[model samples]
Target chain A: MIPLSDVTPSALNNVTTQFILLHMARANKEPGLGAATCLALVADETAAVHFQFWGSECDSFRPGDIIRLTNGIFSYSGNRNALVLRAGKRGRIEKVGEFTMNYVETPNISEIKWVPEGASGRYVPESVVSPYSRIFPPLR
Target chain B: MAENLLRPQPYLAENPLERTLRESFDTNRRILDPPFPLSIPTPEEYLCLTRAILYSILTEGRTRGIRLKYLHAIVVDGYASFTALTASVVDELFERLLDDAKEQIVWIAGEMVEVGAQGFGDLLVSLLRQVVGGDYGDGNMWLCFEEASLFLRKWSALLEEDGEGRSALCCGFYCFLRLLGDHCRTRWSGDERLSALRQLEIDFCTKMLKEQFSLCMNVGRDLIRMLQDLVHVPEFHEIWKDLVLNPGAFGCPLFSDISQIYRIRTPSRYFLLRLTPEMERQMRFLLTNLKLGGQKRHQAWFWNKFLGTNPERETLVIDLIRFVCCAHHPTKEVLHSDIIPRWAVIGWLLKCCRKNYVEANAKLALFYDWLFFDERVDKVMNIEPALLLMVCSLPQYVAITDSLLEFLLLLVDNYDVDRMALITRGVLTSFDVLTRSGVVPSSDALTSAEGISPPLKERLGALLLRKEDHSAEAHAID
Candidate 1:
């Protein structure tokens, strides 16, 4: 698994990694969908990012589960309207361990306000809107 | 420009956590109006953003001045409209777009339809279909009947117009009412959420029909057509049963008679063809109650007078005409439905054509069902012009009857006859058509007026001569 710090905004394709979910918020329904989704904060010792869980995924994983993601996407999802690392269609995730790894939960990738402007005209984090998940208020 | 100075620029810096909280705080303060000057989603930029919209999506302050509150409305409208022709690339971004679209789509549609914007009208129609189609769950679809009724009231002129737009609206209204009836009739348990959803939709359906129907004449007519169409559906029969059997379930749809001959249209023949036994039973119940004799009080509040002096009584009869006509045009539907008794329609025609007497009607107003009894109903150029216009606009079958002759002759008794000006332009045209069509005898047109007072004889006699002269001119010209 890649170190969470290496999973940068520049990492666009084939972002596979493993992390412990430090905390998760409740599932929410966005405007169009008939189903609810959840947004949470996950971390590895080196860095942290926001993660979205859809359908059964919401219930399958919990705050302490150390999960593995294969071919996952780190992009915008749900009402949070921010980038989140998620097990998108080509991606598969399974619980490999629980609370055994060191992790950090700051600078949620979802909190970063991304805009399409770079030297290459690709999505770049123009500003960081928040350092943590708003829904899953940072565990004090 | 001064207001821009006050809006915090927390979004510009690389601090996502502070920005998210601040956005929520902004939303809560109700300071959500989109400051458009700052809002911009560049097409080439939006195209790039459209693919993922995840990392590319902007936060509250980031997306070129788009306010989430209004964006919510835009989204609801988009959700409701089946006709939203989306570009192929815009697909993936919708889930991302949902955050912005999270509000009710109520008023936007009425405004859109009013402005005659095509895409928005489809949204309103879709919103209607969503509720009626039961495509929503968990009370999420708050079918604002008030808005839907307002939609008809607001967009009617355009909806009634002839074109692709008109046809789409026609189909929209047709499907909407039919689906609404089905929605109301469906069974649901009284769980708080489900019950509220059911009740709101039902209330909207009832109000569109009852309270607000008469707000505009064309809207009222269109609503009637929808209800008539609704009753024909087996699934919709319950709403029909409610209207025809439960007096309270129905409302007086006619508020004014300014609806000239121009307003009447050929009503659907569907209900007429299949007037089932159950339908026949309910219509009879409606007719029996509609008879003005028994229903003088519950139908009105401030005005308690019966058909003679009561505004409610008069309005009830007028609404009764519209209500039944909604089932089918009064003339043709009468052949099937008992809701409109022939005698009552004739009685109404005569009542409408009541001759006006200025001094008599004014003085008679004070005695209005009080200690005194008086109804010197007549036309003195102070005619019951509402009744006159209504009488003139009836189906040609009703307008050409011998009963109409009796209605007009009732005015011949008072010979201060002002034969020069008609109450309205259409009234004169209708009268001329009736005369030329032989419904009114051409020869000695006022022969019966010879024995009236001198002024009456002179005026009536001159009108008779003018009619003959006009007939001669018609042959010479046309």
Candidate 2:
């Protein structure tokens, strides 16, 4: 399995990684379809990214649950400009273990201020937003 | 549209962006890479930094020249918007970004056109979507309405002058209009919902004319075509005044070809969901913009002052015979049922609609014909024949001076004599009431009766009791 840090926004790379959920935001209802979604900062040893859980997935996963994302995607959500990492339509995720994986929170990949022009002429990070999400605070 | 998949990036390298950004920021930096890659910035800082970059462009792009390569690098980097910016800042930020983009198109000699598009195209659209979708400060409906009004005014100004034969800028402006339109169309909703913003924008835009914004010849054309999909303007020609009276403003004039004029289809009946509330408000806003009172102005100026009677009480009653009412727009059924309770009689009957009588944009006439004759009506909406009789029986249904009667005669001529007989039987169901109703003209008026078909006149004559038999006509009929 590759580290989350290796998954860049150059193209849609089929990602399969195991990460422990550090925190999860409340399941918010979306606008059009009103589907529920939960946002949480998930991490493995190398780096971290915000993982979004949709519908039943939002309720099934919780903080400290080690989960394996199979064929997940990293991309920007339409309408709302937030970049996200999720198990897209063709992807799947399931609980693999308990809170056993080592992780870090300071580099929530989603919190970086990505300039439009990055080092590789892709959306590279510019600065830290915060060590964690302001909307969904990390579980103390 | 899934724009990211098909789009091509600009040719600028990454190093120039870091350098140019440092200059724009006036800071010493080896590189401008994020402290952590792809991290979302604080909403406040993102807004601050974005505002600063816009300032540099609007200022520098105006005085010095466009930093084309620098701008290209920024767009190529790809925007990582992990959060939706609040509504409060969207309008301000969008105005600056669009204004700067507008200037970059004009003063930069077209080199920055792609930069303006690639950079702000998605970003500004996302921002505008946020603004239009969110509340204007305190959630005041009027404030929302006014903001929408102002936005329509602003976007309408984004015109490209093929003045110098600069196709690049024209094409870029066209893309912007297209992108903005895609985001704003087809969300049917009440005023309280975000979808109503699309309707408000549609209504506000219909009020602007191309003549006012001389540079908006291309942009205005795009806007109207965009609007044509939102609301059905039955009289598209009336708006343009035949292009003869108002020349050259249209890039593609409304109803250019005779066939195109006939090609009009109203926005699907999904529009009817909010029509009852929206229609009044839209009409008022449009009339008020023209410095006229709402329903009162039409009643006073045309009917009272000149027509020698009140038009408020008069209605150009459309007898939609067989039932072409939309399954989606069931509200018309409510209005139809209320015909007898609301008023004594829908005093003026507009003759049945015909194709040749009305101009090319005869969609209303066409709709009436399709409603009566179309086979689809039987499948969906079953219009009762009793309602037609009640409408025919209204006390003041026929008046000598009503201009609408002229069109009804033409309908019988166009369709067939039998159709008129059907309409006459429906209207004059009871022979006793037929004597008081002079729907059919006197025989002496025959010289002018060519417009009315013979079968229709004969049907009307059958309903009419002769003056000699008038005393016993009711008894004889019974």
Candidate 3:
């Protein structure tokens, strides 16, 4: 398990973390695939991220729900052109608690631009696309 | 593969308490037969059996008789562990339980009360906390009915059962009196079930007040506040007359005057009687942890969950303010930090009131301590928020400051005509201590603010000046 701030852009589906759901967007259905997905803003004490909910997950959680993701992944989506945190096929998510955790909206991991370091091929922050989430602004 | 105890929400982790009970039941299912082991079990084995039996009582409806029989036979610790587990289940799993499980819990409570189990009072208090203040829904009303019936049926047992006997009823007394304030409202008088429940609550409250006046007195000043709401009800009207006119009617020797009730500050625990556990948790988190500007989302979530469902729930704002002002006190660190202060939350709650009466009641709850505040008895924190709210709201919201000051002045005169002097002294002392103690820098924020209306200022000045004249006379005499 790791804090949300430690999550980096990775395809290997091994990010385990917990956060409170802050804002959720409307569910959208694919034109041909008929699969539904919703984007949500979730944050732990350290940082915030854009979390994509697939299928049944879209309606299962609401704002103020504290969710724990097991073996989750943080990577860019092919269609949306934005990075997101998700529990894709080999991962899981569960509601653990609610309304008790602290959070920070700045340093949204999803909005940062990551670049591959020299030959080690590890992702590192190259530039800031935005300080906080552009899609879901912080609640004043 | 086994029967579950709680209704499973998607993506929600199973509560460990429920999980342990379910596991105990499953692991011991085959052995729960006629030839129950005759040997006395070890303490650990005793806990396991108790957990399994409780789980079966809630879930295995067909074999509940056998489970109860086994439980009665093996009771060595005064049913302490069993009742503790039952209380925990009620606290943690009551809202998420299946409908049958909910019924089973109430029935089990009846069993606990029937047998005079240890710690049964806490179980009853936990159940009472689940009775929401402004809720008029069928499920909420049903719990009210069942719990009220349980109290009425076992009244004698509750009075004489154990060491926890009277105190538990005291909790029930506080709960029902507070609840009756909502139940007796006219808008919901048409509902048959609510009407029945209201009658039962009146019967129980009147029985306690008439038969056990001292016990009712244990609930302190909030009892007056609760009964004040019920003055229009015929039965409570008679009680009110006795309270105001004939203090001897109550028959409690220590109770001489109504001011005695006013003098005792309502304990913080009694203030918690109205809030559900979840609401209490969220409010505590918001006040203790969240910063000023960052509380918007949390506040929205709280309102959406607790208040958005019913218009009647706006009535709960009054109780929430009382809980915040009296029950929850922040430490000096959080108080001095940028954490959202209690007064801001009260100010927000004051704004949330949609009805005029509720708004008035919320403000009254905010400043109830001020009317009867005695520095020797009452903690300064209880009166701190109203003063800070008045001072803090001066810059951006002069209306909040204006209305609060006006309300304080009005309450001093109108709250109790006969005891106007006492009420005046209470308000005067509240302002003096808050300033002298440095809770606020000075009263100048209110008295000398340019934005405040002159008429309200004149009244405030007169009230404060009157106190000084008396003090000066004492000095001159000395």
Model 3 sits at an interface RMSD, in angstroms, of 0.7
| Candidate 1 lDDT tens digits, B1-478 | 0112122322122233323333433433332343422345454433222221211122322532243334333332332221242211112122122332212234344444554554654454444333323233432244434434554565455545455345444444444454444344344333464445445444445544454333322332334434653464454466556544553444553332222212343233222222222223334443443333422211221112223342212322322232333342233444345333433443442353223321122112111111111122211111222223333434443433233333333333331133212222223333444445454453244334333345443554554555455545545532
Runs with alpha carbons beyond 4 Å of true place in candidate 2:
A1-140, B1-266, B269-281, B284-294, B297-478
lDDT by residue (A12-103, candidate 2, tens digit) is 64888888777778889888846788877788777778888888788776565678888888777654457688888888887765433556
After superposition, candidate 3 runs with Cα above 4 Å error: B469-478
Tens-place lDDT per residue, model 3, B1-478, is 5677777788998789988998888877876777898889889888999999988878877788888899999899989899899889988888888877788888888888888989888888889999988888878899989998999898998888646778888889898988888777748878888889999999999999999999888888888888898999999899999999999998999998898998889889988888998899999999999999889999988999998788889888989999999999999899889999999998888888888888888888998999888877899999999999999899999999999999989999998898787777788888889999998787777888989999998888888888876455434433
TM-score ranking of the models: 3, 1, 2
What is the C-alpha lDDT profile of model 2 across B1-478, one tens digit per residue? 1001011222111233223333434431211323322545455544344433433444445422333333334332233321122111232232323344433322332232222242333233222232221122223233334445433444423333223223222323332232224324223233254346445544444333333322324332223333333233332345445333444444454434222221232222212211222222322232222211112222222222212332211211221111122222234544444222111111211232222222211222222322232222122122222223223433333332112233433443453343444323222232222222342233323313444445655644543434334335424432
Best model number under TM-score: 3
In model 1, the Cα lDDT at residue B189 comes to 39
* TM-score for all models, in order of appearance: 0.26, 0.24, 0.97
Candidate No. with top DockQ: 3
Candidate 1 Cα outliers beyond 4 Å, as residue runs: A1-140, B1-100, B125-138, B143-150, B157-161, B189-478
Fraction of the reference Cα-Cα interface contacts (below 8 Å) that each candidate reproduces: 0.00, 0.00, 0.96
Model 1's number of clashes is 18
Docking quality band of candidate 3, CAPRI definitions: high
Who is ahead in DockQ, 1 or 3? 3
Model 3 chain B poorest 10 in a row by lDDT: B469-478
Clashes of 3: 0
